[model samples]
Target: MPRILIAILLSCALSWPGIAQAWGPLGHRLVARLAEPRLTPQARAEIDRLLAIEQASSLADIANWADDLRANDPDLGRRSARWHFINIGEHDCAYDVAHACPNGDCVVEAIRIQADILADRTRPDAERLQALKFVVHFVGDVHQPLHAGYARDRGGNTVQVNLHGKGTNLHSLWDSRLLASARLGEDAYEARLRLDPDPLPAGTDPYTPGAPAVWAEQSCRIALAPGVYPPRSRIDDDYLLQHRPTVERQVQLAGARLAELLNIVLATEVSR
Candidate 1:
């Protein structure tokens, strides 16, 4: 695709109604913006090349493309919706492919597949662009503790609750509510997270042996943490105050890990 045309298509796609609304637009952009400056020069240049194919300005612009795929393209969405999350039993801390991610149909697996595609230079630009979007989105998804929560509740989607007097579900609450409660724009959110004096360590590689699984497991533990899943359906100020730090930390970790992954994959010299 011509670079200018690709850019136009992305602009249209981003504005379409019902774009995959993960992490709310704010959260995904925050992750992308945070990762932006941390990218290695090689990775930055490669990313620029890929974005030029679609005419995107930055990682944040394409961060939610996979979600948009889910909303606007039913066939692709149906096939990829499961790619956004993994469901583990509340009792299970371990992420076993057979029990939790049968046939590799989960976020952890999706990250692996997308990273491989993005890393392979021989792949067509269109394919790599799609993979790049998936990597950007899934990194944010895995950071959300509920995305790796109990299968019985559909990762807390089915658990109805009232947060700040508004009816919502546990999954949605984690996905957007807490972050939204801060009332910060995407830029502010990214700035605040970047200012964290203590950031979580990035993984050696996002696709390293057991890395995605470990990320999922870490989120699972957070989901199972006390008060995360309240006994009652109503969550108020106290709840938000308690878990806010965890949310901030997760975002920081995700951004750092994403930069680490992109740095490794995009820095590799893929032969034409």
Candidate 2:
């Protein structure tokens, strides 16, 4: 290969790793922050103990650990990158494990696996800590509508769009743009989301059997919802206005569900 061509290939290789994350840092931190206060006392203590292995102060501090690992740890990154999302068909909003995720390697399956590991007391603390990080991140990934979108577009990574005069792909737009467009800091965003009327009732458990599948399906439905996919790849204030509620709701749901999963898995002592 010519020197220039080799350089171009190397650049693409470096950039690809950066783009593999969902929700970006702010969104993941927001989810972790929201879930933090909701954890049961036992769950909180367990989380703190496990996280101390890395000398982290809070869930939010380590919320993006999985994404960071993708760039710094090549072997682990290659093995885990695909666990971030699953691809359903363009016309299909339902999740069929056999068809959509045949290998059981997608986000839904990742969540289930991590939850089990987190709940297994016999596992090493370091192993359970890694599971906790994934459970935090994948829960947020499942709530991002495009993460559960059609594979034809690589979850909209190929669908270019101009939002508010800035050029970007649909996946990046949902991953960070819309949330950033709100212009609210993380605390403000969390506070605003707290006011949403659709509360997770006091005793709700979001981790029932098949619940991860249900969550991914809901995201697929949102991706296919009217006005979500703009014609001609141009989005303006109207599009943002239309979808802001969905974004807010998804974040809220992710946070609440993450808390429920942690409470169940971490609060109770797991019998070997």
For this target, which candidate reaches the highest lDDT against the unseen true structure?
Answer: 2
lDDT of each: 0.80, 0.82
After superposing candidate 2, which stretches have Cα over 4 Å from the reference? 1-20, 269-272
Lowest summed lDDT across 10 adjacent residues in model 1 is found at 13-22
1-272: candidate 1 lDDT, tens digit per residue: 89999999977664332222447777888889888888888889888888999799899999877877755886887678778888775557688888888877889999999999999888899999889999999999988888888877677777888976788877777777788878887777777787777364555444473678889999889998888888899879888788877887888888888898888888775444
Clash-forming residue pairs, model 2: none
Candidate no. 1 TM-score? 0.88
Q: Candidate 1: lDDT over CA atoms?
A: 0.80
lDDT of 1 at 69: 71
1-272 per-residue lDDT for model 2 (tens digits):
89999999877664442354678888898889888878898899899888899999898988888888866886787778778888875548778788877677789898999899989888999999999999999999999989998887778887899977778988888888778889999889888887777457647655665789888988998888877779877778887777777787788788888898898777675432
Give stretches of model 1 more than 4 Å off: 1-21, 201-209, 270-272
Error of 1 at 132 (Å): 0.4
* Candidate 2 local lDDT, residue 201: 62
